[model samples]
Target: MPCLLLAAGRGERMRPLTDTTPKPLLQIQGKSLLQWHIEALVAANARRIVINHAWLGEQIELALGDGAKWGAQIQYSSEETALETAGGIRKALALLNPEPYFLVINGDVFCPGFPIAAFTSRFQAQLSNGNKLLAYLALVLNPPQHPDGDFYLHGEQVNDKPRDADFEERKLTFSGIGIYHQSLFADLKLGEAVKLAPLLRSAMAKNQVFGEKYAGPWHDVGTPQRLYELNQSYDPK
Candidate 1:
């Protein structure tokens, strides 16, 4: 499956650091967040990677040209204004519209390892059932900074259940990682500033949104403090 890395956010929360360098270019343990993602994706044998850029976008292109160094080909989706996650994906669909299903991820998140086989297996199986799955969300424990959390996990589904109170407590934050089928945004007008939460919620109502719990080291890396913390965690003895 092709991969689309959403790196166009202005990252308002990560100022000072983001004041100079793009957030995805910020290094964690000597490798840029974008580089680390490229490495992992290549190892998983994902060849075509689409990266979207907005603020300080030139740096991203200058730093990782063509993605050849990482054994992958890169296509950039340059957003003049930082489009929210869904908007970016919608814009890049023409470039990487991975036929049946593909993966999308945040460029700023720092997760050291991702299980590619597990994701591929589930994706293929879900497609065999003749169903149009919207997204296969990866959920994780809520971080200390945002305890309210993002979504609910009932079995393998990730979504909202306003009908039940217990479902609210099943709060699990999105890992900023997901698989997207072209059909998910079939009705979307490209470049429209739209958040995907509503579309995902609609999918959830039909039990089409599947999820997996990944207990791994993942940092939001959206603020200077978070960046510092990640750098310290990767500090070598």
Candidate 2:
């Protein structure tokens, strides 16, 4: 399996700071977000990665060259304008993520503890079961900022149906970490922008979307306040 780093957004919510630097290039502690992910993925023995960039994209290429420093091979997919998630994936389909399943991540986040090796087990199971789309969503307990929550979890499946009095409140936020089968993007056309929500909803409707609760600390790392917070708290050993 391969990985795709979704790095192309312009960071509208993250204003003035983003005016100069790409969000992924923003520092958390001493390391850049992109650098941290690169090192972690390489540690997981994930040797190939595809990164799509649009805003301040050129600098990303300059900062992380062929991935030799991190022991991985990197390829870039350029988007003149920010293409929502689906379009970025579609653009990079050929060079990377050509296989059955691949991991996709938002570049602007800090997800140091996300387990990359777990996919090996999931991939084997999907192979045997002939599963078409197996998305391993990273779920989080609701935060004060996002009280509504993103989805509900039933085993590994992500259900849109809110919790009822009869069911346990399995409120979970999409950790921005997910594994996707190439088949998930099957209907997506090339050369067009597409958001991932509707597509995932379609899969969820079919019970093909799965999720996992991640207790580890993950940050959206948006807004100036968040940037200051991460810079103050980030530590890697």
Candidate 3:
């Protein structure tokens, strides 16, 4: 499957740093955040990649040319303005549309060792089954900054609400990583700014979304403190 690395966010919270550079290009531990994801994706043998950019997008193009250095073929989706998650995906549909399922990763999040091959394998298993799965997400424990969390995961299914009265469910934060069927963004128009949560929720209500809790290392590098702390304390196991 191909992959889409979302790099178009304005990164308001990462001011000063993001003021001069795109958030995905910000360095952490030696490599730029976006590079980490690219290397991981290449390592997993998912080489064809698409990156969308708006703010300081030129620098992103300069920083990682054709991805040939990493043995990956990369194409770019340029937006005149920063389009939110869903909108960005919609804009890049031409590149991603070739495959029925494509992986999307947040450019700002730093989860270096994430098992892309394994995750996609699991998602493929879900797809091969008779059930029509629209999305498969990787959920993580909520960080201190976002204690309320985002979605509920019940068994292999993801839910917008805790519907099962008899079974307990854990609300988990979206790891900013997921495999999506192209149809999920079929209704969206190019260049329109839109968030991805509402679409996921709609799919969740229909039991079309599946997710698994990832216990591996994951970090949402949204703020300066989180970035600083990760640089100072992160020890790759």
**For this target, which candidate reaches the highest lDDT against the unseen true structure?**
3
What TM-score does candidate 1 get on C-alpha atoms?
0.93
- Candidate 3: give the clashing pairs: none
Quantify all predictions' global Cα lDDT against the true fold.
0.85, 0.82, 0.91
> Cα deviation in Å at residue 192, candidate 3?
1.1
User: Please, what are the lDDT tens digits per residue for candidate 2 over residues 151-193?
Assistant: 8898767878864778567567787788887887777888689
TM-score of 3: 0.96
After superposition on all C-alphas, the RMSD of every candidate to the true structure, in Å, is: 1.9, 1.9, 1.3
Candidate 3 lDDT for residue 99: 65
Model 3, 140-217: lDDT tens digits are 999888998998888899887986779776689999999999999999987899999999989988899998999988
lDDT of 1 by residue, 1-237 (tens): 889998888777988778889989998889999998999899889889999999999999999999998899999999988778778888998899677688988899998877866777876786786656778988889999879778888766677764486644658889899997788888888877778788898888887888788897788887888788888877533
Residue 51 in model 2: shift from native, Å? Answer: 0.3
Which stretches in model 3 have alpha-carbon errors above 4 Å? 165-168
All candidates: TM-score: 0.93, 0.92, 0.96
Q: Where is model 2 more than 4 Å wrong at Cα?
A: 119-123, 126-132, 163-170
